[model samples]
Target: MQIKALALALLGAASMAGAQETASTAMPDDMPPPPMAAMLRPPRPDSARPPEPPRENIAAPSRAVALIAAEAALAQCARDAHEVGVAVSDAGGHLLLGMTMDGARPGRIYSGSRKNAAAVAFAMPTSAVQARLQQGDAAMAARVKPWMVVFPGAVPLMAGDRLVGAIGVSGATAQQDEVCAAAGAAAVKGRL
Candidate 1:
């Protein structure tokens, strides 16, 4: 019995060794390495790019405009005796500026970011988002998404009919937050 067991163990060892060799050599033996030029080629020329239908140009708000809007929101919040946090984002939902008052709660910072995201996502005021959410369960279901704040604390920063960006305020009552955000949006209106 011992002799039979020893023979089985040896066979198993031989099988494992064969498996390791096969695994190690399988790829390199079956295929050549990729050419260096293929791996490190420059980007395709513009003409080589896939043809796409022409689309209207998009104009995102500048950093300077975002800063002006954020500052205006914070100033309005302060004037209303509301210590608040503010965030501004460009049309592409890129954060341009963020500010927080000395006494503002830490959560307000996150709330402000969410409000900004919500405004840019919907391309409208967050108050309108709130109204849409209240319209029906399906609207609320479709509207309540991750990282969204469907509340009254943000408004689009519009330059004429185009949505340039958005400004959001938090750390106050919903009405007060809306007031601050509106003030911020007003500051950047018609400035393009």
Candidate 2:
């Protein structure tokens, strides 16, 4: 009888220990498994992080320079007896100033803005882009965006050899517009 009691007590203790071990190791049914990539990656040390890259200092036109350019273009158009719209844009192709003469068409303002965008995008005068397109340069034509105007009405503003911005003119003949835009860009050449 004593031997049998001892055997029964040992069996009960073993079963309880087995049940506790299973309960501790088993996962809950509602819990999701860890991601494979996260589990595969080893822990990183604080000193192992990569250094940040240096930032570039981009150039752009100031508001005062943009206004001066726009006003100069409008004055040039007036002197030539042409009612026109003019737009000035920063190096980032953002419109800084836009103006139209009293007799200018409403759409001319938008045209001027598009022309400015094209000059800024090409980093040259829109006339140059037009010339390249005319020469059967399919690659250059493909680079033109829908909002860009590849007309002869825009010029890139330069400060010494660096492009700072662009000026565009509309509501007149293409040649006249180009003349006005050139005057505007030239106005701020040294100041920019």
Candidate 3:
């Protein structure tokens, strides 16, 4: 009737531009994954597996097992009549070996080297150094009494991280200076 209504208005404007170009090429069923900067990190720890040994650097327990445990702890403190003093030190404690036994007390060279240097500088075992010299704490009982030997025979020679020194047995009772410093750290347990 008017060019048949202008050909049905150009076929309903070309089917509404082909249904808006097929809904702009679709794709949206909830969508979400894709961003922690695109994900992938996990690999870092091998700068050459080799570097760890210092249990106090160990070792200082030798000096020919400090002269066979200061001659078997001064031959069992001369079988009880007691007169002793023995020493050995190195892992920074100094002295190598020192003796006295034959009726000690040449003024106990200052109480047997300050009680075996306060028992090898307090590595423990001299009855907690007589309960820290009975709690007066004279400056930490004088730090094993001048460089440690705290009686009951000073010890701790170890071998690995290498301390390799310290054994002190002083004249009798500290339980016979720990049985002659445990017979000089058990005659050097096969070189620790």
Candidate 4:
């Protein structure tokens, strides 16, 4: 009876050892034990990851388009009896074209350039920037005003979803300037 019991105990121990080996080998060596939530949740789709090889080049507005936009904005301001200054800047905030209506103040050129630079830097309409400032973004408002004007006189240019540059108008009321700047942005819409 003792020998029979010992044989059964040895067989049981061997089976337990074999089971442990099988369980360990069933999983990859590097895979961590899955979280409880992960086991219960569905697998994530592949689309969650961004596409490989991201876009390298950025599209920018051509010089001709900037000139045309500036001219158009200037003409629009003329119709309103406003002596406005218009400016266009590249994505890097470098001036591309600037124009002033015949009776516009000389100082308007400086304001227009500042507004354009602000629009490019912020990547939004200056009116939107003003709105954000008004809505209690004091830190941003303070940080940005030294280098660029934060009024409603400029807007970022977009070629589809891409930023191309910015257009700005000055020498008029903030609203009026915004209107002119918007016109300039519109003129170059389809042409990119």
lDDT of candidate 2 over 1-192, digit per residue (tens): 799666666666666566555553332221333333333458678788678678445567888888888899999999999999998877766677889999998888778878877888788888899999999999988878766788899999888878787899999998899999999988888899
Quantify how close model 1 is to the true structure by its C-alpha RMSD in Å: 14.9
Report, for every candidate in turn, its global Cα lDDT versus the true structure: 0.76, 0.81, 0.57, 0.79
Q: For residues 91-114, write the lDDT of model 3, one tens digit per residue.
A: 555566777866587644334444
lDDT of 4 by residue, 75-129 (tens): 8888888998888887766677888888788978768878877788789999988
Q: What are the per-model numbers of colliding residue pairs?
A: 0, 0, 27, 0
The estimated TM-scores of all candidates read 0.66, 0.68, 0.28, 0.67
> Best candidate per lDDT, number?
2
Q: What is residue 139's positional error in candidate 3, in angstroms? A: 1.7
Candidate 1 residues lying further than 4 Å off, grouped into runs, are: 1-58, 137-140
* TM-score for candidate 2: 0.68
- Scanning candidate 1 in windows of ten residues, the lowest lDDT window is 25-34
Task: List the candidates ranked by lDDT, beginning with the highest.
Answer: 2, 4, 1, 3
Candidate 4's TM-score reads 0.67
